[model samples]
Target: MTTLTTPTAARLAGITRTLSEWQTADWKGFLHPGDLGWNSMAGAEKSAADLRCWTADGTVVAIGMFDGEDLFRMAMDPAALDDDELARQIEADLTSGRVLPAGTVTVEARGALALRKRLRARGWNEGEPWTPLRLDLRTPVPAHPRDAALRVEEIGLDQADDWISVHWSAFKGTPPSSDDRRRLVHRWTTMATGPFAHLAHHLIGYDNTDQPVAVTTVWTAGDGRPGLIEPMGVHGAHHGNGYGTAITLAGARVLQQHSASAAVVVAENSTAGALATYLAAGFTASEPVTDLIGSVTQRHP
Candidate 1:
């Protein structure tokens, strides 16, 4: 494997735009606009690409960022490295100041276990701290939504405020500014046509007067891999009507129509209580991956 780093000062949007496309295309929803879990190296913006690796022939293989000696989103193409090769790369990254505090990695179950084993063998054991779970799309969902009043509808940009209000009210004390909410909704609307969003359905639930009550966003990797549901939310007052489950199936139907093999689902450890909603929607857990922050090397003595 060959690693390449370029030192340049360019607009953050310009550099990260390519990285975002690369992620949306190749990395399968790993570095989304909402996830700020990456390590920053050479002071690169957290939302953009800091370092990229490619196969000898120049095809990109892995992409990551570093903050001090920590790393995050260290995804590598399996065909390019064996266990020893992987270990060597990790070590080089650690000692060379290429990675920083948030430096961590995640892969599919088998791959994650393999890397975890390699890191352990190399004395990198902080812990198995994060347990991220995924939902496979190809599986058949229960034939129906939870109820009839639970209507699933596309959230137009005009009605973005309605959706925003639900989130604002849900979070209550921590409401964002109007501009922030506008940008947030714009991104969601953009996701309706995003690379991943291109083949999927994005939906929201509404109450009797057509006000949004719940929201769930789903999309595919464009490789027929499966669909993924993210940022699923139900307003504070509408929690018990099975709104979450109904909309989840609505998205699953879209996946099933595409002949997808699985749908992926993830929730941080703090949100374990919501896992039951997914379980009730006919989703089975594949594996749970930890979501960790800070650093073992820099923070630990």
Candidate 2:
């Protein structure tokens, strides 16, 4: 029998453990352990509050997290990909207004074929697409002469401010306020100190002038499974200097050293430049995946 429940503090660790075990070399648009770490930017308590899990015989079979009030992202255990009953239960909860509110909502379940089929049969439309790119790390990464001018460092707590500065400047295009700095620091600290901290690497790239020009965080499920590079960015003022590719390669190298089978990243299909950067770093693109968009009111019985 299958059951659905939100994890408590004791179960949170188990949920993360199950998520880590779900990662595989074959690219799937599934929810990643890194996604949870990145979402911890809001705080672990809030992340737990928004997460739901489906279990069979005391083992997790599926996991979902609400991205804000409207987007519900999920991943199913690959072994249960064809479990129709589980898919139906997931769809029911999604449209029943108990998990998400009663209105239009987006579901990202690219790897969940059974769930996707159910949503399509119910008339859900496809949303925007995202491109997944991956680099096999069985071989050593090629070194670039140009990257010699950039220094990549694996950061610790003391360098949290520098990490926050580059992240805000790269993504927000503005200087971070005191409150913003505090929040970003807390986010980094929470992940750095969490149960899966050993699986994470926080990296920042510096130019010849010693200015922080790029930043990224990499997470690995374990050896033989693909690692993830989430939230990679170049400082807004330094966009044209090849920093994005350099920083990406830096992140990939960390994963390689850590014994990850490959490094994977996803970018919005509309962001041609971001896709280009990953390509330049030797990541091959895979088929793009789109979210399913639907209104709760239109759900079929």
Candidate 3:
């Protein structure tokens, strides 16, 4: 039987660490270590509380989390993708509503999953397309990419406002609260000594006026492994100035310095401009990943 378990607060960190260990660059469109890191940094208490896992003979074979009432994000063991019994069990569990709440649910399964088709057969519609992009870091990054006019530098607590302001401007309506910022800094501080020490990088790009215009946060899975640049953005006013590419190059440089094998980022296939920015930053595009959506089949307590 496939056993399901909700890891407790004490076990959450270790669970994510194990998931990170399970991550490999070759596996595309799956749950990622940096995804866990991002959620943890954003709201550790809430994230830990929402995580769940499926085990086979006591070994965790699948990991998942609910982003709210409607969306579920998951990644399973690459080995188990071909396991018919396991995949059927997973599909049943998910649709049964024992694990997820009833709703018009959306599921993002990283990489290709066998369960995807089963969900489709059960009335799930294929959702939006997302493209993954990568930059090789095995070779030295050019000290300067062509459009390097913006001054980019690594930042810390003292310059949090610089980073936050650009982030707030980029994300306009959904900006984080003051308390969220405090927790983020605290999370960074706590990561100082672990394997995650070299994982997170915060960078800010400045315009000619010395005002922060762009920001990027890169997280390396481990030395010589793939690193991800999540939410790299340019200030609203600075959107057309090439700041996005400059900041992205800056992020890739940071990953290279930290021994990353490659730098990765994902963009929606529909976002032509954003995709163009990453391509301009020298990232190669890959096949797009699609989400699976379906209404809950039952209700869970």
Q: Estimate the TM-score of every prediction.
A: 0.69, 0.95, 0.88
Which tens-of-lDDT digit does each residue in 1-301 have in candidate 2? 7787887656777788888788887869588888887776555677788799988898899999988888999988998887899899888888776577778999989789899999999999999899888999999886755589789999998998998899899889999999989988887887788655777899999998999989999998778788999889888888988888998889999999888899998899999999999998899999999999998864334
State each candidate's clash count. 30, 0, 4
Ten consecutive residues with minimal summed lDDT in candidate 1? 33-42
Query: Which portions of model 3 show Cα errors greater than 4 Å?
Result: 142-147, 173-198
Please name the candidate that would achieve the greatest TM-score relative to the true structure: 2
Q: For every candidate structure, what is the RMSD over all alpha carbons to the true structure, in angstroms?
A: 6.2, 2.1, 3.1
After superposing candidate 1, which stretches have Cα over 4 Å from the reference? Answer: 6-51, 65-71, 80-82, 101-110, 121-139, 168-179, 186-200, 291-301
| Candidate 2: residue 282 lDDT (0-100) | 90
Model 3 earns a TM-score of 0.88
Residue 181 lDDT, candidate 2, scale 0-100: 94
Residue 154, model 3: Cα distance from true site in angstroms: 1.8
- Report the lDDT tens digits of candidate 1 across residue range 206-232: 866676877765654444554566557
Error of 1 at 241 (Å): 2.0
Ranking by TM-score: 2, 3, 1
Candidate 2 vs 3: which has more TM-score? 2
* Strongest candidate by lDDT: 2
